[model samples]
Target: MSDDKPVHTPLEIKLKLSLERQPLPNISYYQRLVGKLIYLTITKPDIAYSVSIASQFMHSPTMEHFNLVKKILRYLKGSVGHGIIMKKNESTQIIGYCDVDWAGNYIDHKSTTGYCTFVGGNLVTWKSKKQAVVARSSAEAEY
Candidate 1:
């Protein structure tokens, strides 16, 4: 991946991860890679969602899943030196923003929600996860 062109994003926005893909023979390596990524998420929120998606296939990964992991690595390579920054400031206001894609999961029709929190105009925490329950409408998903 050193020579491969780096992407600005960790994962494709329209990507639909499914379990119908061909399964791989060996999965020990995939699990190890995902485990490291999970640890990385503590400091790199940008790759948190993509890493979460990739880690889902730890039990029985496929070529598509492996490719997604590669994409994440490439993204990391391109985004070196990019991470949360804390600067001296007096602003103390807390702000948050969140959004969801209604019925994003092709398998179960569950929505995926992403959120971020900022303190004094600086990001402090963020998360992206699939909803446990299916949402009937976009408005419901937002709520």
Candidate 2:
């Protein structure tokens, strides 16, 4: 993945992932990779959605799933400097940004949401997660 062309985004928006697919023979490797990615999310929240997408098939990952994870690896390799960086001497301002994806999941058609909290112009925390309930519209999802 070090030599692979880096993508500007963590996940391919057009790619629709589903559960009804051929399973990969090696599950341990996929599990380990996803685990590491999950840990990496602590700093690299940009990959949170990508890691969550790959984690859905942890028990029975397919080649497609593995490829999705590989894309994340390539992203990490190319953008080695991207991630959270706390700094001092900035304004003690608290700001947050949140976004929602309307029914982005192909299988469950559930919306996904992500949020980031910044303190003093530095990213302090962030998260991305699928909604628990089905949203009728993007407005409802955001609400």
Candidate 3:
């Protein structure tokens, strides 16, 4: 994959992934790759959501999951220098923004909540994770 062309996106838009698909023989490899990607997310929040999705299939990855992982790697290769940079500021206030997708996961019908916190004009933390319980309505999901 050294010569593989870089991709602009880590995961395809509106991608529907499932666990019912055929499992890959080399599950260990997939797990290792996902573990590394998870570590990378510490500095590269942009890839956090895609990496989280890939991590879900660590126990039973399919070719589709592997392809998505490769796409993430390609994206990393292209944007190797991309990362959050903190600049010194006099202000110390922290601001946060959050949102949720209504039933974003087609497989489980669970919404995904995403939030980011900024301190002194620099992004300090962010996360995107699936909700534990299914929301009955979009308002509930957003809440």
Candidate 4:
């Protein structure tokens, strides 16, 4: 992917990937690539969701999954300097924001929750994770 065009987004917003898709035979390279991406997410929250989706197929990745990984690499290439920036500040106030998508995952019908916390205008933490149980309503998912 060294010569590949860079992408603005890590993963296509409309992409619907699943484990049951066509599998690529005998390739351990995908696992290694995903492992690196997982580590990259420590400082690159922009690719967190995309990496999470790609990581799910480590046990049995397909050509489609490989393509997604390439897309993420391309994104990284274009955003080599992109990352959280910390600066000196006087305020110590903490603020947080969170949101959820009800039944966002088509395969498991699970909701995904995302939250980010900030301290004095600097991002301190963030996370995105699938809910343990399927929510019956949007309100339930938010709760």
The 10-residue segment with the lowest total lDDT in model 4: 12-21
Top model by TM-score, which number?
3
lDDT for model 3 comes to: 0.92
Top-scoring candidate (lDDT)? 3
Any residue pairs clashing in model 4, and if so which?
A: none
Q: Which prediction has more favorable TM-score, 3 or 4?
A: 3
Q: For candidate 3, write residues 67-117 as lDDT tens digits.
A: 899999999999988999999989999999999889988888999999999
Clashing pairs for model 3 are none
Model 4 quality (TM-score): 0.94
Output the worst ten-in-a-row residue range by lDDT, candidate 2: 1-10
Of the two candidates 1 and 3, the one with more favorable lDDT, higher being better, is 3
Q: RMSD to native for every prediction?
A: 1.4, 1.5, 1.1, 1.2
What are the lDDT scores of the predictions, listed in order? Answer: 0.88, 0.87, 0.92, 0.90
Ranking by lDDT: 3, 4, 1, 2
Q: Write the per-residue lDDT of candidate 2 for residues 1-143, one digit (tens) a residue.
A: 54678777778876798677788988999999899999998888878888999998888888889889988898888778987777896599999999998988888888989888988998888878899999998899998
Task: Give the Cα RMSD of candidate 1.
Answer: 1.4
> 18, model 1: CA deviation in Å?
3.0
Better of 2 and 3 by TM-score: 3
lDDT of 4: 0.90
lDDT of candidate 1 over 47-113, digit per residue (tens): 9988988886789899889999999999999999998888879999999999888898776898989
Question: What's the number of clashes in each of the models?
Answer: 0, 0, 0, 0
Off by over 4 Å in 1: none
Q: Each prediction's TM-score against the native?
A: 0.92, 0.91, 0.95, 0.94
